[model samples]
Target: MPRSIRRRPGLAAALALLAAAAPAATAQQVVIYRCTDASGALTVQNDEPCPAGSREERAIIEPPPPMPVYVPQAPAPAPVTSRATQAAAATTPAVPERPEAPAPARIADADRLPPPPIFRCHTPGNDRYISEDAEPKPRCVPLQTVGINGDPSLGAGAACEWQYDRCERIPDGEACDGWRQRGREIESTWRYARGDARAPLQDAFARVSTILSDTTCGLPPG
Candidate 1:
């Protein structure tokens, strides 16, 4: 016997009821608007109106990008070159320019000049002597030999003594004509008197003056 086709009426009717049920549409929801004015002041109202003097730009939310699949690249080959080429490639990178050093200081010679020459005479003489180094005795001598005069002995001692005495009375404001210098010492015989009376002393002063001026004569006793 063939299997009879089984059909349930009640099950078919329940399926029809389920197919007839329909969902209702939700009411158009009013969106309360909120915005800021051009001066950045906040504004809120029930009705939708574009904010005054401010353009409205739509705000967008972005999703993050997907993670990338990593694929390793092949290693680069080492470079091969001639020695000259390698040397050119090996040049050091340029360095930043540095400020120039200040110029070396220059010192003036006046700052290190030597002191002036110092010279002082040291000899044995009072205010009268030219310096400390001068002969002590009066420079006078008697003329031993008579000149073309009639007699040498006649006017000899008296005239000689008178002439030499002039040394005791050296004339004021009269400078001696001759002077002798030996090393730092000076010696000189000045005319004490005029006329024949002082002839001997004058002759003596002349001799002493000569010795003083002589380069060969050494410094005499003070």
Candidate 2:
């Protein structure tokens, strides 16, 4: 304690010297000037007045200000929803009812009939009669209706054959000529046929009409 107290005065003296030296250092650091003399000789000095303005240049150096530092803050957290809010959302009104779709159209069942039996009957004169009715004769046999949908060529040939049969049935004169002319007319339509059943069916029925027209055969009303 005694030695520390003795050193205090020396420390105080040193601090006083530093304080006095501060102003002297500041004065030394002032702007410097370059002055030209009467003989055009240049002289450089610190903080002194130029001699009668022969020419003077002063340079002051100062340090630039320090840049400011920026620190980014974190974003605030999102608010949490309470359980009551979730329950209220769940209790909202139910969605509007959707309209019912229209019922599908009801389809009517097809009107059905049993197919008529076709019979083949033979006469005593060795002639054969193909009938659509059930003949009680011993030589009569049932036959199925022929389907001509498979081959269009076969259908056309059958149509021509039916026409010839009709021509044979008619009297061999102007009446048969009429039937022949009808055949020729129907044959002309064959050129325009477009792979349909109508043309051949039409020709076959036209021939069948002559046979059905004969009243002497005692056939039922066509």
Candidate 3:
């Protein structure tokens, strides 16, 4: 074994030289930093290139997270109606409502009803005014030979002859416009002449007479 080692001496020497060179080639160089802390203490360090008695600070760099993308939604459609067409709809007629009938007039007592014919006014040589309320006068000469008739001619020896003429066309009397009328005036005068001093009855009679005259005689020509 001694003789074999003596034979490999050159190789052994070269191996030793490689070992020494390997350490020199692989030796890491270090950079150092020095700084002062909040406590006013100085520090310096080696290894990761930091100040002594201080830890090396490494950068914690990281990429930002991805951003969010929004997608737009479409609005819902409106409903459609299947009604009548425009031209036919426009030409269609609207229905009319029927009118209501008027109520019938009510009649009171038949016995107290006024006569159909009313008195008229006309001037002749001798004039006679007759009222429906006239009574048989004790002094009125009821001549047995004389006669009274509804006529215009005043016959000889005639007791009474009725004359017919259109009553005066009084304003507001042609169409009843309340109480102001000629017939009412004449009635009020006659009521006073009869010595009936009852005011309310006289006024009532006047109003009724005015109404009746307008209803019956108002149809005379106009």
Provide TM-scores for the models: 0.15, 0.17, 0.19
- lDDT (CA) per prediction: 0.36, 0.43, 0.39
Which candidate leads in lDDT? 2
- After superposing candidate 3, which stretches have Cα over 4 Å from the reference? 1-115, 118-127, 133-196, 200-204, 207-214
Segments in model 1 whose C-alpha atoms lie over 4 Å from true places: 1-126, 130-192, 213-222
lDDT of 3 by residue, 27-83 (tens): 332333344444455444322344455434433212233344577989888665456
Question: Which tens-of-lDDT digit does each residue in 67-179 have in candidate 1?
Answer: 45588999999887899987876896644232222332243333322211112232223223332223243434444555457566654443222111111222222212213
TM-score of 2: 0.17
- Candidate 2 lDDT, 98-155, residue by residue in tens: 2222332232223222222333444545554333334342433432334467643444
RMSD of each: 40.5, 31.1, 36.7
Q: Give the TM-score of candidate 1.
A: 0.15
